[model samples]
Structure formats: C-alpha cells, structure tokens
Target: MSEQLAIHGGKRSVPESFVKPWPYVTTADQQAVMEVFKSDGIIEQQRIQSEGLAKEWAEYMGVKYCIPVNSGTAALHMSLTGVGIEPGDEVIVPAFTFWASAAAVLHHNAIPVFLDIDPETYCIDSDLIEAKISERTKAIMPVHIHGMPADMDAVLEIAKKHNLKVIEDVAQAHGARYKERLCGSMGDAAGYSTQASKTLSSGCQGGLFTTNDEIVYERASLLQYFGEIIVPGQEREDQKYNAYGLGWMYRGDMFSQAFIRSQLKRLDKNNSLRIRNCNFLTEHLSQIRGLKTPYVPNECEPVYYNYVVGFKPEEIDLNVSPRTLRDKVQKAMKAEGVSMGLWQRLPVPKQEVFQNRIGYGKGCPWKCHDSIIEYKKDDYPKTVEFIDSHSYIFDVNPPNDLELMGMYVEAFQKVMGNLDRLLK
Candidate 1:
C-alpha cells in the first residue's frame, strides 16, 4: 500500500484540480435521442414518448405508478400536496439537508418542523422524531442524504406509531436500496430529481414521483397536470384548458423525457463505476489521520451521490481549524485544477432565511414549538457537529468511457499526497 504524504501548506499544480466539468452523457445516448428527434413519430406526437418513458421508469423503480415532472422540487411539491399537507400543518424534516427539502414544505404553506440528522447517515434521526411529534404533525419527510439510506425501520416504526405519513426525498439517491427494497418504493410516496448534477440526470431538468396507492397516484397525476379532471363519462369540447382540482403546470418536457429514458437504461452500469471509485477512495483515504469516510449501514446499497469526508478537530495535528483546513485544501486542489469545496453549510435553523425571515420569513412551525415546547440550537447537537466538521467531495459520474477512471484515480492519489502540506 502506498502511503499519502502530508503537505499541510502548499500550492497545488494546475493539472491536479478535480476534473468533472459536466456529468458524463454518452454519445450513443445523444445519438439515440437525435434519432428520436429525426423520426416523424416523435416530432408528430410528444405524449407517446413521455407516457412510454413514464411506464419504463415505473418498471425500473418497481412501483405501480411513476409520474415524470418538470423538476425535483416540483415533484416534491406535488407529492406533499397530493398527500393532503395543507397550510399550518407541520412536516418534520431534517435540518441537515439541501434547501429544497424544506423549501418544498414551505411552498405548500405548511410549516417545516426541522429535526436533527443521524451523524453517520447524515439523514433524519428517526429516534428523535417522537420527541417532536404533536397533534399537528401531519407528515415526516426523510431525505436519503448524499445517497446513504436513512434507518427506514426506525423511521417507519415512528410513523406507524404516530400515524404520520412518510415522504421519501430521493433526489440524491436513485437506484439506492434499503433492505432489498428500492428507495422510491419505500415510503408512502417518493420524489426523484433528474437534474443535471444528480446520479440519474436526464441531460436536463426533470423529476419523478412514485407510489403504489391508487388514490395517491391518481391525485398526484392530476396535480402534476394542473388538476384537470377528466370526468368518467363526459367528453369535453375544450379538454386542454379544463381543470377539476387545485394543481399546477408541472409536466415533463418531451425532449427531457426521451433523453432520460436512454440514460435510465445504463443507470446500473454508471452506479457500479461510482461504487468502485468510492470504495477505492475509502480504502486509500482511511489510512490518513484526521479523516473519516462516510458510514454505510448494513442494510443500505448506496449509490454514492457525493463522497462526504469529515475532519475531526480533535484528531488533527495542525493549528488550523476544521474550516481553515477545508479552505486551504480546497484552494490548493483548485490551483491543481481539482474542484474541491464544501457542499452544505450550517444547518437549516442557522440559515438567515429560516431564522431571520429576511425576505419572506415565517416563524418556526407551531407544531414544532408545541411538541418540543422550545426549539433551540442546543437541541440538535449532533447535527450541528456534523455540519461543522464535514466537507463534501463530489463523486464524478462514471465517464462514458471507462478508461477515464484511471486518470481520476491517479488525480485523487496525487491530491492525497499534498494533503498534509495543504492543511498547514
């Protein structure tokens, strides 16, 4: 085993910079899309391709229904709305997550009662949920953060006991599995992001919602299409503009649908490469002092959306703080052409938008306050510690050509060699 040298305080070379300009979209995939575009069948009728792709995705997710939408946020909003999350209702969410997770809650006029995350999975702490549950607690939205599965057993148990709904935010985890069940199929309903940076991007923006419940599926489908109710036996003259329920225009575009369908065929192949690269990095980096790789629970088959690493303050020999160490290493790696940067900042409670309500702020949800009696930063100690100590390393999508993997491996090793000096 080759050991990495500590280069705590040194400038990086231009070539050593992390190198993922854009996600890997295959030429063959593009060609297939181009062929679709050229065909009269595609140009003539867009709905056929969209419907076909939705069916294909449904099969892929092992769910009864899959509705493709414009974006992941839209999918989340629809899922929440479809399941009856109304104004003033409180949705328990993990504070340590992307803004979209909470944003979806707020969009529905419901309040987001932020909860703490499990430090290992960086997901909602299911154990802490009972303490926050109240009469007003309508749902629990658990995000599969950075591809690691949350403890679904615990989360489900709490939900069952409390009679609360479970909505899985699977934007960061496509093809991820929890206890042999696919992620999108785990909860009452789930949302998937096919954004450009996600594991299963469509070369553009799109999202998917999956559910087995017929009522939930039907309501969600109508919600995505502006709530237009097609009556069982009535033929409407102006069908395009009619609506029967409250909804929005969150339909998926034809081009994005076609592109994603092509990409879906190779998702497993791409995920396998990510797994291999992540395992390699973990095996090598674990030997470095002061560094802690992500923890994978026994039940999870994670898809490695982003490879997160933590630098414990107590473990480091350097005088610099964890934040300073992160900055220095990121700067050096950038100089070396590597794109290393922190992914998430402080928790949601600390953010100005949530805490201060600068532009359009609402006070914390009533249910949260009533349940905990007083929501305080001190309450979620582990969540705060994880945010402060962690920095994210993006796991590049598997290159269209597997040969590029060697270059990536070499670059990572070189970056590791300069770590000690970068820290200084």
Candidate 2:
C-alpha cells in the first residue's frame, strides 16, 4: 500500500526545510563583495569592478566586448540596438519565452513578431523562422530558455540566408552549449542575466552584453551611460557631458559586479552538478506513467536552469485536461515536500499588453509604424499546450545534491502511486 500523503495528515516524504537554497553562496562569495567596499572612491570602485567583470565575462564567452548592465532586459535592449535595430523595425522572437525577450524589442520602439516554439526543445522553432521574415524584419532574437540552447545552426543558416542579425537571449543559459560552442558566442550580440535566481548569480540584479563587432560594442556602450562617451576612472576635467544619442542609465553597481565575478568562477562546477541532478531525476521519473521529462537534443548540453516536467493525462487514462491534472499533481506533490511551480501561465502573444495593443499607449508602435502583424493567441499552440501541461522543479542546482533529488523521486513515486486518493 502507498504511504498516506502529508496533505492528509501523513508524514511528509521530504522533511521540513530539507531542500537547500540556491546560488550556493560561500565564504569566498562574501569576501568578494566585501573587497568592493574596501575600495577608496565610488568612481574608482565602479570602474575597477565593472571593467574587470566585462573583461572576465567577455573572455569567458569568447567575445570581443562585454558591457555590464543593471538588468537582463537592459542587456537585451542594448543588444537589439547594438545590432542596428531601429525604431519601426520588426524583430522575430519566440512566444514561449519570458516577456522581456519581446519587451526589449518594444523598448527600442521596434515591433516583436512572435512565433511558436518547437514542442520538443521549448525554444523557438528554427524551421518556422523563414515564414515570419518580412521586409521590415531586422533581426531574430532566439532565447535559450530554461538553460537549454536553441537550435543555433538552423537559426544561423536562416539568418545568413535572409541577411538578418541574430540576438541570443542567454538569460537562463549561463553555461549551456550547442555543438560544443558556447551559446552567447554564436550570435551577433547576446544578453545574459546574473540575477539572484539564475545559475550564475550576482546576489542581486545584473546583466551582461557581449558582441564581437566593434561598432556594435561602441553603440551599446553609449547606451549604458546616459548616451555619453564618458570614460570610467577618467579625470574629472576630462568628463564628456555630451549625449551622443538617446540612452538609459543601465550601468551595473560595483557590489553586484564583484559578486557576479566571484560566482562566475564556479559556474561550470554548479552547472555540472545541476546536470547530474537533472539526469538522475529523468532516469527515475521517466518510469512514472503520465510524466514526461525534458527532451534534450544530441547537439545541446543544457545546464537545467529549470527542470521542466510535463504531465500527460492520456498516458494514465485520466479523463482530465493536462492543466487540471497538473494542478492536482502539483498540489499533492507539494504536500509531499517537492518544490515545483509554473513559470509562464500563457503565451507571450496572449499577454494583455499585446492583446489590447496597449504598447507605449495608443498602440504607438503598431499605429506609428503601421505594422500589419497581428498577435493572435491561437498562433502559438505549442506554447499554450506546454504551459498548460508543465511545471518546473526548482533547486536542482548544487548544495542541494543528488540526495535531495532522490527524495524528490521518492516523493513523486508516492504521489503518483496514490493518484486515486489525489483525485478525491
């Protein structure tokens, strides 16, 4: 007989406070932040940490230039602008990703053309890129969602054929690789987030922008510092107060940059642990009927930023929608102490901002640019289905370890074994 669920006054499968917190902050991480405070002047500190992090990250990503910014959205916006995405231009983006992927397009007054993701990878469908390329399309922004690298080869090929620039959204894929090449290195420009929850954390909000083109770097640099060509650590008399072009105060703080630098050192190690834990989960959980594990491609090495699980009602002979079954399973699993949650509830195109076209007020971009593109929610069936059926397992990173993962598997087994009780 299956053990009674904790939801019904039974002992919890996972003990209270068993799962460890993320980012795995250590004594060394603490020291790195403290070092920033020891610097003499604010300007000197900012220059040292910001420039150092840029150099370190640029070298890591095998890119020529990197700019540290305040947030991932800022980095993304800079990437689009760096690649010469002008106002009224159109940029193709995946409908399944975080809204920021598309929001960055609109920040520059460009239109975001949303496309459905591949059911398998949950990333943009490279096979569908050609159909969305219009005369006004200036770029294609392929997001490496949930630490999984998108099909870069096919995306690059299409971009080359159509003469469109590629901007990679590496917000969730810090150490992920495709065909042994790093994710951010293959695109014209890329954006990465070092936000607190991400694989490579800054302990707070932060972002990195990287590209090989000098012109693109220069353009992006201007946007980071109030559109000025001001040099960090330069003499006060030499400061340039001129605004070369429109810009935002997207510069990152010294504290966050230092923390990010410290974290970057262990990114590979953390990613490896995440891979091991996720692999273990898949090995055990794949045996459970009606549960679908993530589908990794042969050419990609994912870091498992999120361990996404899909619930298939049909496989278990459940006469309920996947969403309904997913919610019930999630509730029962929570009672057993498994940490799981849904990230996106709807496709990006179905978001109210797009549905009402309330972009920048009065449908500015659509009205101002006279864009003919429509954001019908039905266009992205795969994204809708994925969102309705799946939930992510959190804290799969290091410091949590395989032991906790084993407990998670036990919890799943217990819950699934007693689905009859769960349905009641």
Candidate 3:
C-alpha cells in the first residue's frame, strides 16, 4: 500500500508546482493596461484599438463581422436575440458545456434542450440532435466543447433540415477549426469568451460575437451596446443618445480590448504549443492501461482548452467503479505534484438548476408558451457515463517551456503504475 501511495511516503514524480502559469502576462500587457489608464479615454481614445481588434478577430476567424462585448454570455445572448429567438423558443445545446450556453437560452425566456455528447470527441452528438428537435426548436447551439469542434457538417445539415438557426458556442475554441474552416465561421453567428482561462484570452473578461449574415451581424452589434442600432460612421449626432430597444452595457472595456489585441499577436503560436503539449501527453498516456487520451478527428484541429483524459474501467484490474478509480488515481497524481481536475460532474439537464426548474418554476421561461422540458436523472445516460466516471481534466496550458510537459507524463505514469490503492 505504501508503494502505491505517494501520500504515504512514495517518491513524488513532479515538482510542488506543476500547474502552468495562467494569464501569461508580460510587459506589453502591463503597458497596454497602463495606456488605457493614461489616456483616460476608455472607449473614445482607444476606439481604434477596439475596432481594430474586432476586425482582426473577425478576419482571423474568417467571419464578416465581430462584436466585442463584456462577456461570452453577452455574446451568446446577442447571438440568440440576433437570430430572433424569443419567449418560449427552444435551443438545442450540448449538456457538457459551461452554464452560459444554456443560460443564454433562459435569458430570452426560452428553453434549452440538452443533448448527449460523443464520448470520443466530448462534443455534441450530431446524430442524436435530430431526435430532440421539436416545433419549439428555434436553433441548434452546438458548443465546441473542450476545444474539439463538434461535427459541424452533420450539425449544419440537421439545422438546415429543421429550418433552424445555428449558433456555435465557441467560448473554449479560438483557433480550433473543423474541416479546415474555423469553428466560429461555420455557424450563423457564434460567441467567444476571452475569460482568463480561455485559449485566446483578453487578459480579462471579454466576449466576441461573429457572423457572416449582415442582418444578424447588425442586430448583434446593436444588442450589445445599448441597442444603438446604426451603421458605424453613419450615426447622426442628433441620434447620439438614441436607444431603440432594451440593451445592456455589455461591450468589452477598452483595457480588455487592448490587451486582447496584444494577446492576439501570439494566439496561433500559443495554440500550436498547446497542441504539441497535448499530443505529446496523449502519446505517452496511451501507453498506460487505464488511461485514455483525447480523440482528435482527421478533419478537426482542436485548440485543447482543457486537456481531458478518460479512464477505461474495464481495461485495468482496479475493482472499484470508474468514478472511484478516477478519484483515487487523481489523488495519487496530485500527491505526486500533478494538477488534475474533474470535468463537469453532471450533464446540463441533470444539474440542480435545470432539474429543479429554477427558471421554469414560475412557469415563465422553462414553462414557456411552447416548451416545458422536465429534466431527469440519467436522461443522457451516455454523457453521464463518459464524464461522471470515465474522465478527468489535466489543468495544463500551452506552456512556453516544453520540458514541463514531460513532468506531467511522468506524474501520470507514476500514479497509474500503482493501481493497488484503487482496488477494493
């Protein structure tokens, strides 16, 4: 038992701090933030950088327009609102994503129909999406969950057949591409987050709304910043303060915009490094009997937002359930100085917020005019099986120092080398 337990005085494979540094800030980032303060013109003086960054992001993603907002949730709301999702509307979304994806649907007094994800890709199962579509299904919000692009080709076809709009929740994927085309560019409109942990971080909280459709683009932009719906540079001064409808102060601040632009300079490089690290770890981890690496598709180039590893219960001699085995393995790994994390514990529909019908209780959104979804346990059995027991995330980043990745491989190997602790 001592041989299998790092906590019980076995040798630790990694250093005390194995976590890759986050918000990888530099002098340029500090200077950029200072410049925002020095100018005292948050949006007015730095408008060029703000506008330039928006254009730059759109161009990089191969989209026609980009709207910079305060958060990914804001962009999502704008996407749904832009595409005319209203009260009682239903948006089909993967159950594996952040709360924001479904929260946006509820934001508009609508319902989010949760679908199971593909165990291999950890993304929305395109095949299963069609089964869940109903008359209330207004759109398909396929999240590129964990940076791997969902089956967009299949998703798009499903959307088209159902006459539904497509809104890609691209919060985790920045440079990720599906079939050589970027993730954000494929949907009718997409939302991106520059939250601190995201691949293309804005150095602070930020969001972007992108689309090729001119009308959707226009409406999205207006919805973010006070609904000042007017063509840029053509706004008459007489209507400077004219707000046509309900709009929130959702635009990203100038400081965030400036830093995001600076970070954009090395976005691709960072993603490349992350990809290398992930691939290297995958190669090494696959050798261990119980560990499973991420499944990368031939047509998809994922960004590796969260490097997830799956646990195959049957392959190993550990008698415990997959969940218990993963917990013990992760504990042993952490003792060996590796930072491991749990992926989402519950599928979206099974979350207490959804099952309890928090928003639907008043019979408002969840109990909308059209859809009343009763979320149940094990509704998405496949999704639950994959995540609840089979998977755990390694909190890694696209580190500039490649050698640190070796330590991760060693730590994982050491933990897996001793499975006796997990055996009942």
Candidate 4:
C-alpha cells in the first residue's frame, strides 16, 4: 500500500542535484583571496591578514588570544604543548570522537586515556572522568563532537577538583555554546578547524587556537612558528634566529587566511541557517518510528556540524542488528537522493593506532614511557554501540534551505516508511 521504495525502481523523493554542495562560497570570498595575490608585499600582507583573522576570532570566541595555524591537528598539538603536557602524561578524552582528538595527545608524547561518552549527548561523560584521573593525568581533552558542546561546566569542575588543565577540541563546533558560554572560551586552550567542510570553512585547510592564559598563549605561539619569537606584523625584523625549543612550521597560508576572514563575517548567519535546517529535520524525522533524531541538551546550543541520526531497530520490532538495519536504510535513502553516511565506524580506542599501541615508530611514546595503561576497545561499550547504530546527514547548512530539508524528510519517510520492501 505504501509508495514503492526508491531502490525498488520507485520515484525518488529528492530529485537529482536537489541538494547543493557545502560552504556556500560567495563572490566576496573570491575577492578576498584575489586581493592577497595583487598585494605588493605578499608575505607581509599574508601576515597582516592572518593576524587580523586571529584577532577577529579571539574577539568572537571571547578569548584573550588566538593563534592561526595550518591545520586543526597543529592547533591541538600546540595547545597540548601550551598546557605543559610532558612525555607520558595522560590526557583523558572521549572514545567516540574523531581520532585527531586522541592523536593530538600522542603528538605531544602524552598518552590519551580514552573514556566512554554520554549515550545521549555523544560527548565525554563528565561523571566518569574522575575515575580515570591519576597521578600522571595532566589534562582532560573533551571534543565538541558534531558541534554539540560538551558539558563544560562539569568538565571545568572536574578539572578544578583534580588540579588539571582542560583542552577543548572545538574542531566540529565553531559557534556552539554550553550554558551561554562559547565552547573554546571555557577551556584552558581550545582548537578549531576551518577545514573546507566545516561550518567556518576557509575554502581549504586552516585552524585556530584560543586561550585566556597569557602564559599558554606565549608558549603556543612559540610552538606555532618554529620556536622563534617572531612577532606578527614586525616582518621578522625583531625575529631572533635562536630556537627557544622544538617547534613546527604551523603557520597559516595567505589565501586560506583571506578566505577565512571573508567567511567569518557570515559564520553566525550561516550557523543560524544550519540550526534552522537541523531543527526542521529533527522535528520531522523524530516522528518516524525506527529513526532517532539528534538529542540537544537544554543547556547547550549546537551549530549542527553533522545532523546525527540513530537507527533503533528494536523499537520497530525488527529482529536484526542495528548495523544491518542502518546499512539497509542508508542504502535506500541514498537511492532517494538523500545525503547520509557514517563518520566514525570504530571507537577511538578501537582504531588500529591505539589497538596496536602504535605511537610514532617502535611504539616509542608508549614504550618510552613504559607505562602500564592498556587500551581495550570493549571498555567503551556506549561508543561502540553508538557507532554501530548512527550515521550523519550532511549538507544541513545554508545555501540548502527548508525546501531541501523538506525533501530530506520526504526521502526519510519514503525509504523508512517502506522498510519491508527495502530489506527484501
């Protein structure tokens, strides 16, 4: 009786090319990048633009300092160094987040102590953090996964109690907030990514590091530019060639910086659009029996970097694994022209890097430290369950409005409404 499913030669709910690509580049973005090319002092102009963006981002984030970097990974590593994360120190992180959240700790020779996430929020479970704290615990890195801000108040309380630092990984949460406070501003130092697919895209790879502590800022600044005290806008005239310590070439490029500057002007507006679109999807999708819409906490405002949906086969009396049902639904939805896919298939601790204890060559950090901590994948049951059941719906941002959102709802209805046919 239901309309035939798309995979079974039925009419597609969303027409081909109905959903547009991400980032929604504008004419102003092009002009800004072009302006950099036309400048007489290319490097000088680049530095000016890069520093200008840092200032703007720091103001927007309500933080005291911002460092522009080449990538989010670099930003996180700089933050780790800024927080005095010495070798063998353990940094507690959520197991369900992107691997970079843990990899950044390894970059500093610090062991990442993976913890389980809150099943509802998909952020680190603040209640479980204290159990993981130890004598070697240096900091707690909580990733704002999918732009949903972590429980920063609880995290800060735990950090204060344990006398530890909190480094927020705001890579997926550019404009998100927890209890009216910005995600990056609440932490000792936070890292953000301006990668092309991110909410605050730079049209390519870029990153920002923010901190309220002057000491952390100065330390991170040293690590960002090859350990030298090369002041911005000084043209390296006051630069001392002496290497204060080990550092990396983590500077942002001129073109990406210019594009980010142009993009920052619209970040809030774009985030509003994303919030609208995601809210609409949640409203409609939540009505479907087997599909679970994202759960937003009362105290947080997320930017919806990814609109995550969970498959609840048990709710629908389906005698199948959640992953099996999810795979079938995802395929059927794709046939209906819906953009949905999984982000992380495995938990962070389950990844080969951690499973094999591979840290740099020869397991140096793990071996060099000679610590007895173990990374068992089964320790994070919630993260494994979440990954097996949920997938992200992409393009839920600006340049793709309510009409596209309506089509997405229609696609979900058509595909999930006829799951019997889809499974057959």
What Cα-based lDDT does every candidate model obtain? 0.74, 0.92, 0.81, 0.90
Q: Give the TM-score of candidate 1.
A: 0.87
Model 4 ranges with Cα > 4 A deviation:
none
- Give TM-scores for every candidate, taking all chains together and pairing residue i with residue i: 0.87, 0.98, 0.94, 0.98
Model 4 lDDT at residue 31: 95
Stretches of candidate 2 off by over 4 Å are 232-237
Say what the RMSD of model 2 is: 1.0
**lDDT string, candidate 4, 324-401, tens digits:** 999999988888888889898888888888889888979868999987788886899999889999988987988899
Ranking by lDDT: 2, 4, 3, 1
Query: Least accurate stretch of 10 residues (summed lDDT) in model 1?
Result: 1-10
Per-residue accuracy of model 1 over 278-338 as CA lDDT, tens digit each: 7776776677666788888889999889878777545756676776665665554454444
Among all candidates shown, the one with the greatest lDDT = 2
Candidate 1's C-alpha runs over 4 A off are 1-21, 41-44, 230-241, 358-379, 400-424
- Model 4 scores a C-alpha lDDT of 0.90
lDDT of 3 by residue, 114-233 (tens): 888888898898889888888888999999988999899999998988899999999999999999999888889999999887888876698999988988987777788787865554
TM-score of 2: 0.98
